[model samples]
Target: MLDQNTSAQLKTLLERLESPIEIVATLNGSDKSDKIKELVTEVAALSPQVTARFDGTNKRAPSFGIAKVGEQPRVNFAGLPMGHEFTSLILALLQVSGYAPKVSDEVLAQIKGLNLTSDFDVFVSLSCHNCPDVVQALNLIAIYNPDTTATMIDGAFFQDEVEERKIMAVPMLFQNGEHIGQGRMTLEEIIAKLDTGAAAKDAEKLNAKESFDVLVIGGGPAGNTSAIYAARKGIKTGIVAERFGGQVMDTMDIENYTSIQKTQGPKFAAEMEAHVREYGVDIMNLQKVSSIKGADETANGLVEVTLENGAKLESKTVILSTGARWREMNVPGEKEYKTRGVAYCPHCDGPLFKGKRVAVIGGGNSGVEAAIDLAGIVEHVTLVEFDTKLRADQVLQDKLNSLPNTTVIMNALSTEVVGDGSQVTALKYKDRATDEEHTVELAGIFVQIGLLPNTDFLKDSPVELSKRGEIVINERNETNVKGVFAAGDCTTVPYKQIIIATGEGAKASLSAFDYIIRSGQ
Candidate 1:
């Protein structure tokens, strides 16, 4: 049910509609269908022009078939529009009511000019913050093109559909029953994808099984540097990465990357890719390294890196530049409220909580940095740390303290994320020093605890790892195993900065070259 203020706002917004909007919900007597019908009815009752009808006997089981009245429905939703996805539902209603597309004129013109009869089936969860961006973008395109139909499939209510599609993440898109990419993307990016038709082609096969003089795992700054160094030596080089940008894609600001005064993560990632592509390095993106074997001379000497999809790459030497990711707090309600109110990347989701109070759970440099960056966008930031003192740099701490909207609370451990059924509302924490419990009422939570190396694939390998699970390496970037090396935050590098990682990657490539020369590979 809508509150008085929300109902008033909806009424006002509906008054702008020049035509009637009809929503037909197909139900199958499930609890999810009941909730969907209730929500649609509640929202439709706010305006005279808006109407909702429910059908309980439909064989579709549970889904919303929405379209303008007196026309065949072109849109379908399989889940309840709750959490951040409620915005998508509202936008769908508004668009059906004759709201103009929010995309640029160029994009709309390109979409309108499209001759392909496209069907976009988007899968999303209710709590996904990134889902609405993709849904709205696709819906706007559908509004522009009469031949295009956009469908929103809820990942929750349609568990079978999710499993069938092998969907591991939200915002997974499909074009005419073929799987596209995942995650939120801009309209321009989507259009470029459609124009290129790369996903449809690339999804069929990754690459031919090829051998390289040196192979670099991961695709961050370190991996790119390693590939370039190897390729420059006139050696057959290949770089296989899960994502081309690695963890660097999530980074919003970079000021200490040597000469660059300022750069965003995606921009830097694109630059790195462009630079790497200039060489003959056989770059394989979107492949996960499952395991490594036979690095020793006694066992064929060639290192074979196996992928999750049963593909393998053989190389004389392998450099592990797999990066690190943000550590999770692993508290209660964390998973349930993810993207609803519990968010990890401040740069990606901060704009959604504009003028809303939020909490940052950490006191390290990353935490303070997130707080500082979010302070300008959000109304207030409550920084919670388990340590008695903040571990961030003095400059960052000073900047954070200078902000009147920021509050630093030391010796506090985040215990749980509290939220309503639809969205997050507050955060619960415990004071380690006083043994007292406290709660902060906020709209969102930004977690920047620390870094965790993505090195689980090396657990069974002979490459020695530190107690902290980081690959142990010498100054020359050489691991204990022969012809195997590592770099970046995943290694025992003293400083986990991008510049240091890049240098280490270069050194690792040189070391691999030296090993190759000595071993006569």
Candidate 2:
């Protein structure tokens, strides 16, 4: 199954195995089963410590379990772990063979200390870039705790179960047969859900931290850049984020990032985080900021930021780079049918709607690209645009128009998402030119309108904001509030590109440092 270079790489990786490991598979005499057998046999041949057996009786055919030689398999793959899941398979192999995972010691301890016996089944599509994070997280949990088991189920291969469960999203997770989550989730998020006291303890620890010279509020490209620049100045720096990578995690392709020729979003985000780590910046992920108080509001005369968990962190200088998120339709039934039939990420959730009719809710580059991509997998695509003409580049518009399965509706306003109480059935829109309302029957709706700034927490603060809710900043990236600055998509920067955000972040960090030196704080 693996090519020459890939086999050589796997052989090199397998040299780190500390103990013997076994791949026990269950086959049912089918084409997929034969392929699985060949894959396992080839994998076993790579290392002397690895062995394969096809005598097991797992109900899921063409499936295999990876485990230490004599232990019960805690990590399982119900389908071919190729594509984005290839890394997950490799990690499972290494971790099960006694190689330590790269997670923190605290997180590792939490996983091993879980008192509950849980079974996690994650449904994923091969093309989804976000699926590997969820799969690898649960796989790590299973590796640490003997009572827990994680099984990765490829939705494309197991169509019957996906249909029965009415799954329309990738990385949909179920615990003990109950649907728990339906999107990308981190290992910390999963542990916080299982361990009820974790948040309280974490909050207490955060509250006890000493004040920082510079504290960044987000973990996107902007926030990471600011943190790194601040840390390099020999000052204490920290970053608290709801989730690292922010909107970048949802992006699919990025070719305009200067030196890099081409790269995926998640991979770029991972590399950004790794680079920030080299600067020794304290990073706290999966934490939400509830409010930000000016320097005068705190007794210590330092800027204060409060967390959703009631943890208050004090910093001399605060940099806000909260970033933005996908703009919602905000129409009737849109919220109710989210994940059921409505989705914002075409690259992540497109595979679930194969051979089905879908609608794209914009005419910009993102929407046009989504329509062009979905036309290949879905039966038909209806592109609805509020403007009179498409705003995408000429090349993209030409490609979209060439697709036979695509229909473009210009000067149409989306009114509502019509659903049958469970899933979307059609999209309601009105023709701007004729004032005629129309409905397009579809099984899925992909919203690619635009982005909304994540500045809700700063609404009541003293920082000035533009009419569009973006934080107002000067050329130096300084906000109106003293000792506070802003950058990235959340700020009044004309364009919201990753490179621009990164430059703004560096400028903001330098501006904050200058402010501190002038004030002698």
| Most accurate candidate by lDDT | 2
**Scored by Cα lDDT, where does model 2 land?**
0.92
Candidate 2 is scored at a TM of 0.98
| Clash count per candidate | 0, 0
lDDT value for model 1: 0.80
**RMSD list, candidates in order:** 11.6, 1.2
> Which stretches of model 1 miss by more than 4 angstroms?
1-207, 297-299
Report lDDT (CA) for all predictions: 0.80, 0.92
The TM-score leader among the candidates is 2
lDDT for each residue of candidate 2 in 214-296, tens digit (9 for 90 to 100):
99999999999999999999999999999899888888899999999999888899999999999999998989999888886
